[model samples]
Target: MFKIKHVLLLSFTIIALTIAGCKSQFEKLRLSNDTGKKMSEALKLYNKKNYAKALILFEDLSQKYRGRSEAEELNYYYAMTLFKLRDYTTARFQFKSFADTYPTSRYAEECRYMGAYCFYLESPKPSLDQENTVKAIDALQLFINFYPKSERAAEASKYIGLLRAKLEDKAFSNAKMYYELGGYDISNYKAAVVALKNAQIDFPDIKYAEEMDLLIVKSQFAYAKNSIEERQEDRYSEAIGYADEFAESHPESKLLAESKELRKDSEKGIANAKSVLAARKADYEKYKAQLDKEGKKDTTTIKTPNK
Candidate 1:
């Protein structure tokens, strides 16, 4: 009786295991089928340009198929949906996440490219903060490296060029504004000089490099003109320093001849002021001495004049 009971228990256990295995398989098939249907619907909406609805369907599919092949596809399409909707900030996040999650996937390179485009999309005018420009440059360069053969490689390269020039223009515009605002004061002049130097560093080949050189020279000349008469010598010295730097940096610049003429005038003015100041001091001292001698002689003359 004990042996018979044991066999019956064994038979019941086998039956239960078989049923459980079939149920698990059925669940897997059902999820797969549902995922395919959802993906199909999302694609239809995407094709119709109904991004609002498409995004919802894609996002739902991504969540439902987490840890499955369908999840990766869903994530990629969802990012594209966000891009189409002009929701670049969220799209950028999604693309970055997908790239990280599927670095070896076939879509990795395209994901990176779109990520860079999203950064480009977020960038404001060249005059605004350049945080997005920097990010775009980094992403584009990475795309260039990873997908040299990609169809979008040329476009990525173009964006990099554009972004770099934009940053350069922003710096140049700021420095030019300082110069325009009568920035001949010591602090203002220094600020303009620093900004122009940074522009050169950031964009050596920009067409306005020569223009910036001229502005630097003009700033120095103006600064020299505004100094106190007594301090004009020091001011001229500093002005000549910037003038020389500009001349050396841009020997063939269009403003070269004019800059030289200004330097010469500054030097001559310094000399003439010093000479006049010295002569005035000498004349004053002589007059003071003569007055003192005359007073002493008159005091000794006593009443002679009245007699």
Candidate 2:
């Protein structure tokens, strides 16, 4: 038992001594007037991923090396340290600043890409606020435009597509919401039709294209059926047009059954409307013939003053 206690005590002593040695060495280098030594140590710490210590040293060196040749490298490391620490907002700002301040530096292009990439990292999911997503897209596009021959252009383009899809998702949701809205007083069905149409135009290759077009057909059917008799014929015809479009576009869609049903209903509605219009026309003609047989002169005349 005494031997084990001695060993444990010795281990604890060694650990305590190691900690004190590190702390003392760090303090010694921190207070020294030797910027060269500090720069070397900071770089070593940064490369080792000791961002906390690297950050402290880099901050100190940033002010010391201002307007000097070493400032470029120092600022680059400082911005990267911020990025590695997950301080993306500040890191992005610093990266952009680095690029602007050192436009001709070898690291400028990389820092510009990093600035945009930071925004991409900050982007939320499709369902959340997309301000960051927009910024990411804009920044990335600017990067691509600024450096068309860059090796990073392909990756930036891929990210731009991803962010655009997210925007498309938001648009789809808004349009779908209009479809789901209740009450005819709001004309939400019209809004739904307009929204879906715009989505189709904006994203022709949208993954939801089939579903959205099917929805448009359904909305047209509802809008037609609920309309007054005067509008039912024309509206039902429009619904038929939409149904035909969906059928031609997606012949194998599972929603084909629903589209077929909408077609049947709209055709029936059109026939009924036509029949009613024919009956009204016949009744008007019959009344006019009776008036003619009665020799009715229903014209009115205004006589001018005799001259």
Candidate 3:
């Protein structure tokens, strides 16, 4: 048993020393000035899926070979190594740089597509800031434009559609936010109507078109309901118009009934507002007549003193 244990320990020590020696040898190769050997070893490591070590060797080889014919292949491997390690930010820059530096290289098309795809991968959710999403759309579109005949153009177009959908969702959310805040300030309701209309114009085929139209009707009604009495009649008339349009456009919508109800209420609001305005006008006229009569009597009474 003792001999068996001793033999096992010896084997383990031999394996550990072998691994350490290999690591030392790799380190020596990495620090050496031999570009040709480094490139050969980097490609070997990359093929073995050892991206971390491959990246070190490729990075070193890149500088030594720059402005030379071999630099193109070395830089391509370096960027691909970064991508394999999931360093998307740096990988994207490197890929773009590689494409720009070697537009006629066989790898240029793939590098350009990959750089744009990295932007797509970095895009955040709909609720977050969408700078990356917009960039992805633009990058992907530019790729498609440059490579209209390329097989990857279809995939690029698909990504652009997805990014545009995200933008549409953001626009819808922003408009809805204004509608929700309308209870705090009546002006926000009008703002909501305007914003929702703009969204419809901008995204004519938007999936939320019906919902946004419903919100517009609701916002217009709320705006008229909260306006001052003098403006209520005109505002309510506008609300009624919006509701009519909503009903006409979204005849099959589940919210069609709600829009019709808003229209009915707006008509009633206009009538009531007109009644109040008429009463106010009569009161003002009566007060003016009384003031005139009192002034005439004072003038007649002062005539004798003047004579």
Candidate 4:
């Protein structure tokens, strides 16, 4: 029984040692005062392109110096590490937080630019949802507003312009699709009008606005031209509308002469068809009366005519 008691005490002692060793390991991490040393080490790792290890170290430093002067440096390093590691969302968040918390810090402007860049990196093609594109544009605009003299300002402005153009292209393409699919009765007017408006807004000084306006006039003319004769007066009336619009919008267009000729043809066709139909109906009535009179005379005078 004494031997068994000794074994039990030895086992308990070993377990206690193991637990203390684990506790000490955690305490070392918790109580370490080597923040600057750790930061330097992480920077070295980052400069060496050891992104994973650098990320871990920077994250630890960010936590260690949350509100200290080192905090901004720590956050910047952390965000850079995540960026190098291709962890963009976390990098974006880290940069945003750093900028927001230290807006007046020396590193603040860099953080703002990089934060917007992170969003720019996340932007997808226009075929995809434009949530990131919009965010990127807004961030870039804010960066310019705050740092108009920044060396990066021109580049940021250029990117914002490209992104806006991409979005406008998507909008224009969608509108054009409606016109192509004959969705007019379903409100194609809206699409054509919006397309022209967007082109005007986006490329007001370019040839695109002029071209889109011409297309709108053509589409409106075609829609009205398809109506029946009884419904055709409205068609000609609408054609005149497009003629007027085209004349006013593009008076010097090479297409002006053709547009005038088409209008004249439509007017002449309507008048000629109506006149021909009336003339044929009148001739048919007169021929029927003559036949009736000849038949009655023949029935009355048939026997005397034989002699």
Q: Which candidate tops TM-score?
A: 3
Q: What would the per-residue lDDT of candidate 2 be over residues 28-118, giving only the tens digit for each residue?
A: 9988879999999999999999999999999989889999999999999999999999999999999999999999999999999999999
Task: Score every model by TM-score.
Answer: 0.75, 0.79, 0.87, 0.66
lDDT of 1 by residue, 28-120 (tens): 543565767767867887999989877877766776789987787788889999999999999999998999999998888889889999998
Decide which is better by lDDT, 2 or 4: 2
Question: Backbone clash tally for model 1?
Answer: 0
lDDT of 3: 0.90
Question: Looking at candidate 2, what is the lDDT of residue 44?
Answer: 97
Task: Give the Cα-based TM-score of candidate 3 against the true structure.
Answer: 0.87
Q: Global CA lDDT of candidate 4, please?
A: 0.73
Residue by residue across 31-99, what tens digits does model 3's lDDT show? 999888889999999999999999989888877897899998988988899999999999999999999
Which sections of candidate 2 miss by over 4 Å?
Answer: 183-186, 224-235, 248-254, 269-307
Better of 1 and 4 by TM-score: 1
Number of residue pairs clashing in candidate 2, backbone atoms closer than 3 angstroms, sequence gap of 3 or more or interchain: 0
Candidates ranked, most accurate by TM-score first: 3, 2, 1, 4
Each candidate: how many clashes? 0, 0, 0, 0
Query: In angstroms, how far off is 21's CA in candidate 3?
Result: 2.5
Please give the CA lDDT of all the candidate structures.
0.80, 0.90, 0.90, 0.73
The lowest-lDDT stretch of 10 consecutive residues in candidate 1 is: 298-307
C-alpha-based local distance difference test score of model 1: 0.80
